[model samples]
Target: MANQSKIKVCVAGATGWAGSELAKAIAVSGELELVAAISRQHAGKSLNEVLDIAGTKIPVFATIEEALTVPCDVLVEYTKPGVAKHHILTAIAKGVNVVVGTSGLSDEDYEEIGIKAAAHQQSVLAVGNFAISVVLLNKFAEMAARYMSNWEIIDYASAGKIDAPSGSARELAYRLSQVKKQELQVSMEHTQGVKETRGADINGTRVHSLRLPGFVISLEAIFGMPDEKLTLKHEAGNSSKPYVTGAFLAIKKVGSFTGLKRGLDSVID
Candidate 1:
């Protein structure tokens, strides 16, 4: 086994919110070394220039091929969902493990990635929501599902977020569905007159999405009983530190995992 201190990393989407923060985290983390960064728009800029972190002047490349020139053991993907799949696939094909944070990627996308990972003997891990509190929210939802059957998820993100029923919400619905005994209310059917008024329905659970400017990422798992309601909520503020820590954990752990692993909880103890 290689020494832990020698692990090298590449950060894709180095200029974006999560990517830049993750790059900064990698720069500060003593266990891992930042070897490359990829961002089409930010190419030619140094890592220090793009992330505002001094000392390392690693050249940024606009394409993955260019960035791959740098020696790296893992790739941390923070690009959009569509872009992320390609990056992860490419990394795995080249024997580089991946820790993906971009949302909106579907199960089919992951299944394909799994095939590639198994063929190459590389690791691929995807996280819908990286915030530790959000991780706990999913954990608690799984536990709550065992006792309750009537539940719905409300997923909230900024207005600019393109995906409907945000990844976290979909994951929660999927996890809850695994344990939920009774089917949930189908709220979409009753609101036929106004389609926008209704949110996306998952299995039997109705997942309502709120896209507004002030919100970062937030979710509420509402469970109902004969007369009472239980709400498990997780709110993420503007800070990217929480997500960065989780991303770091995922990147560090992916290599040890032999195949495709889904969700941040898989890596978390």
Candidate 2:
């Protein structure tokens, strides 16, 4: 109800590829305020000066700790996986809800963060990718897994992305595992050639991660049955715009719950 009653938000990695776009959108939203930004490269400068966006004099801090001093209602974590967990925990420790837009966070990281969020009575909504198409892909794929006896996931991302088997792939694998067990793959001991070629087994699903130059981010689920097969795919272009709306959605819904929830599907109706 303060500062024109906008939902105050702090964006970490506010100058990065996706974060910058999300921050710009937040600046123009009447219901949200871009209160503080965290970007080490643009530290000590006002977001208005760094991003050249008018009407936003938000300060850019080098660390989440410095940024959280502004007392935001939500902390949007868009930084790298290495520092993302720390930033999220820092915000939760301050009793602020979090919407995670970062990637490459391991399963262990989410477990640790979930515990911290619960102890602080805070909520953390971590979405692998905010693209609406990608969100729907998980749902559609889950349905396919229920009927198909065999399936595999192929995850593609830019070569610079260090995470193997991306968050999207992990999410799909987890969902399919919940529906049924993977009962169709050959045993590693009985494999003919190299067993490593089978791709990493993720919760009963074979998940293969490809790091190539042309891909921004893409995911495909291939389902197979007798004399028939189906493939579901989702791809994103070079722009980060597809992610803003969903990240904004997370900011709106994170305060509605406590502890960690993966994907927008968890909170979306």
User: Who wins the lDDT comparison?
Assistant: 2
lDDT of 2 by residue, 1-269 (tens): 35678889999999999999999999999879999999999999999887788995899999888998898999999888789989999999998999988887877888999999999999999898899998999888889888888999999999998878887888788778888886765776788998888899888788999999889899999999989999999999989999998988999999999999998999987
- lDDT of each residue in 191-260, candidate 1, tens digit only: 5587755555675567799999999889999888888889999998888888877887887789887889
Candidate 1 worst ten-residue window by lDDT: 180-189
Q: Hey, what RMSD does candidate 2 come out at? A: 1.4
TM-scores, all candidates, are 0.91, 0.96
Q: List the residue pairs that clash in candidate 1.
A: none
Model 1 misplacement above 4 A: 1-4, 180-182, 185-198
CA displacement after TM-score superposition, residue 267 of candidate 2 (Å): 1.2
Model 2 clash pairs?
none
Index of the highest-TM-score prediction: 2
lDDT on C-alpha atoms for all candidate structures: 0.82, 0.90
